[model samples]
Target: MFKRLLLTLAFSSSIIWFGSCAQKSQTTADQIEKAKEQHAAVVEQTQQQQKLLEEKTRKLQEENQQLQAQLQRLQEEKRELEKQKAQIAKIQKFQNVKAENLQSAQCEINPDLGVPLNPPQAKPGECFAIGYLPAKYKYEKVKVLVDAGGEKVITTPPKYKVVPKKILVREESKKIVVIPPVYKTVTEKVLVRPATTKKVVVRPAKYKWVTEKVLVEPAKKVWKRGRSFLTHAVATRFDPNTGDILCLVEVPPKYKYIKKKVMVEPPVVKEVPVPPVYKTITKKVLVKPAQTKEVVIPAVYKTVYVKELVEPAKVQKIKIPPKYDYVTKRVKVRDEQFLWVKVLCKDNMTKDAIIKLQKALKSKGYYRGPIDGIYGPLTQEAVVNFQKDNDIPITPGAVTLKTLQLLGIK
Candidate 1:
């Protein structure tokens, strides 16, 4: 009995173990299925995320390409702007050079007439010796000198006279006569005519009646259904199996005939002539032509005293001495001569020097004008007076070296 009891207990334990193992196996399988399902769901979600990323990347790439194109265009524009700037700069440089050249060319210096040093200096033709310099120079030279001097004497001859003698004259008188014109009565005949006008007539224009025809409705295409003669069946129009007809029908337009007047010929004009009227009238006519008669005239004469030249006009020679005087004259020994000498000219002259000159003149009571820096007429006159008073050689209207030295201006 105990062995049987043991066997039963072992069998019961074995069955319980088997059942637990089956249950655990089933739980593990369920967990594994749930894990597989979750993994598949995550993988599908990852795939969707990757697709979205790819689409975003594609859009970004397209935007980047467009931006790059814009950048390239901007770069090209920048290059064009730089080129234009360079060209403008080059043009400005050329203009500057041209302006400078024009300024220089316009300010050309004259070589013959040097700039004036002082206002009072004698110009080229005034005095025996005049001072001037080469153009734009600081030195003086005598440019003129008289070549000759002379005096002339004149004489006049005595006057001549003519005399006339009187002779006997006679006077005469004569009787005069005149003729008068004569006229006679006369008669004349003249015709008087009057102007006449002719009558003119214009005929009315002629016309004719005509008729014309016009269309009111145009031709049209229509569809009609009919029974086929071969099949004896009615069908839709334009069907091939069914007997149908497509017909083009022209509907005549309704028109009415009416009479219309149209001018066939223009009007005609006729003119009738009328004879001119005339009338006769009486007038004065010349019978004998007018004549002029001459009257006798008597002549008178008278005698008068008259003067006549016995001798013809003749010139009498009278000896006249020439008028003479001991006149002093300055004669130039040499022609115009030039010699270079250190001098102050306009190019090197300063306002200070001019002021000093004016002051000096004023101090010596030679100048009565303002002490302006300009060497004007007043200063020139002062210089001349000073030179004259100091017994300095006077170069007419010129500021000479001797003059300057005497004034202590050198």
Candidate 2:
């Protein structure tokens, strides 16, 4: 009985140990499942956090790119501004140089005069002693130095002057006697024959016969029957209607010679005429006698006288005086003078003033350079050109007030 009890106690101890071990294993399994659930929740939270961070990073990169683009645009604008500034500066420098040149040109001195002088003036109706004339004389009372030598009168003796005496003297006066011309008509025979012509005969035309050869028949093509032998015995036949055979033979064309008569040419004859003519005329002869009549004449005589010069005339030399008168005159002492006047010079010129000048020049089609406020060489040249075209005098390199006014610039 004691031995049986000890065996029961050992069996109970073994049962309790197995029960404890089973309980410990169940607890371990439950803890493992809970740990797996917690791990899955932590992984999900980490993935969400990572996605948010990536989105933030993407936005930052976009912002950075935008900032960079803005920076580049600003940089380009800055470069353009710098280029424009450089251009403006260059133009201004050129304008300044041109202004200096103009000033120098205006200050040039005249070659003839050591110093500037005012021009001479002239007044109308001004008199001046031109020259003098020699003393003049007039025709004073002209007196005869010595009476012309007296002329002596020659007196003729008192002899009887033979006067013209016409005496009726008896003289035979001759008279022309006229006799009528006598013409005797003589009869004479002259031949006046008419022209005559004779006719001629012409022979008839004649012709000769000529012999020639002519063709009787023309060349033609003809077909004839022929035979052909073949290695194999074949039937040979002739086409009665078409005259066609295995081989055709050519027939020669036939022709005949013919004679013909032709006329070559004919001969001709002509006739001519001969003529004769004659004429007759008549004439007359003349015979005559003439006589004269008698007339009377008379005698004639004439008388003459002698002459002598009485008182004679004479000539003498005389003097005359020249006329004189007073008149007004005008004279020029000097030419007009050009005086230097104050103007807009380089020292006093400003960008604004230069711009105004440039604009004015441009309006007149003088300044083609840039309108930037800089007064460059081009601007100076424009001013010069403007002055020259307008007939305005250029004063060295100065922008004279006159020039400004002409250009419509203040």
Candidate 3:
């Protein structure tokens, strides 16, 4: 009864240990699956973000192209405006200077320098500069007969020519002559793209996984006991080397198989010859020479003059009258004026805004310094020049809104 109980106890202990081991293995598998799920989610999110970035970049490029086109049109308009402003300035240049040695009867306004005479009537939120109204003219063509028809007399002159006779030379003469060369077309080859030898892997280095046995534990000798079959007694020996029944015991070497790679062939390089290309061409060659031939002569005549009526004798009417044309004359319509204008100054701008402003000015060929996002002397000067060139209100040390509009920045 006790032996049976001992076997039952040993079996129960083994079952409990095996159940715990299986639960641990199941937990490890679940962790591995969870890790795989997390990795996949991360990969998907990365791809989505990349796509978003690409879309944004494409949209930015399209916007940039549109801005460039708009800038081009603005620059063209600015140039035209600059031309008109220059003409106006030229015409109105005398407004700022007073006349010298003038009598009171010749002048209608006072010569005082404090206020300008006949200034332009400016409206609210509007600016004005000194500009002259160019002269206007109306053209008229007068129809006055320059030439009147009258009778005319014509006369014919006489003509004459001289004649000559040719005498016959010796009999017929023979002369040697050379003939031009002839040509025939032929086909030939020409190398357009040169022939070159290149390295190629004719037989690449090959490898294969081969199973090989490796020794883990080597063979070793150990002492063992010998038992008597009749008495069933344990044999006790003092010296392991000296025993009553000498037995040889050995543990065979343990071996294991593992996959390994073995090279089958090595890489190779070979030189190969390439054939040259050909093309057909036409050429000239000497085919025949000049031969002697007979010649013939003919009579020649001299020039002569003959009396002929080249033009009929008739009367044509002719008359002379007055000539007339229309001429243009300038007539002043309005006087130059001066007024105040609005502009951008240091109070309403930041570094980022300045950077964008600088870029716009640079693209329009107004600014030449680096885009350092600084409202420095270079930027201010560029703004003034741009404003002047585009016919915007040129307030010193400030940029007019009209200038920004012309630069396509607004």
- Each model's TM-score? 0.23, 0.26, 0.24
Candidate 2 per-residue lDDT over residues 1-410, each given as its tens digit: 99667545655664575457546644643454455546557657866786787688658855765665556556655765675576446434434444344344424545352324321242343211101111122223322222122332322222222223344434544442222234566766544333545544354445555555555555543434455453232345678787656433333455555455444544344434444433232344566532122323223222222223333433333332322222222222333224444466454578888889888889889989999987666876787677656655444355767788887776
Which of the predicted structures, 2 or 3, would earn the higher lDDT when compared with the native?
A: 3
Instruction: Name the candidate, 2 or 3, with the larger TM-score value.
Output: 2
Model 1 scores a TM of 0.23
Which parts of model 3 are misplaced by more than 4 Å?
92-410
- TM-score, cand. 2: 0.26
Candidate 2: minimum summed lDDT over ten consecutive residues — where?
127-136
- Model 3, 198-311: lDDT tens digits are 677777888888999999999865445554332333343444466465334565789999988988776787877665533343333446532223323223332222233444
- Which digits, one per residue and each the tens of the lDDT, describe model 1 over residues 1-410? 99667555655664576468557644654454456556557657866786787688658855765665556556655765675576446433423332223223324423343423333444653322233221111223332222122332222222222222333333343322122223343444333334555646488789888775554555443334443332323333356775455333333456655667788997676657656543343333445532223334323232222233344534444443332223222233333222223234444346788788888888888988987788776876686567546644333234566666777886
How big is the positional error of residue 15 in model 3, measured in Å on the Cα after superposition?
A: 1.2
Candidate 2 clash figure, as a count:
21
Which 10 consecutive residues of model 3 have the lowest summed lDDT? Answer: 98-107
What are the candidates' C-alpha RMSDs?
Answer: 63.1, 74.0, 43.3
Model 3 TM-score, 2 decimals: 0.24
Q: Report residue 159 deviation for candidate 3 (angstroms).
A: 99
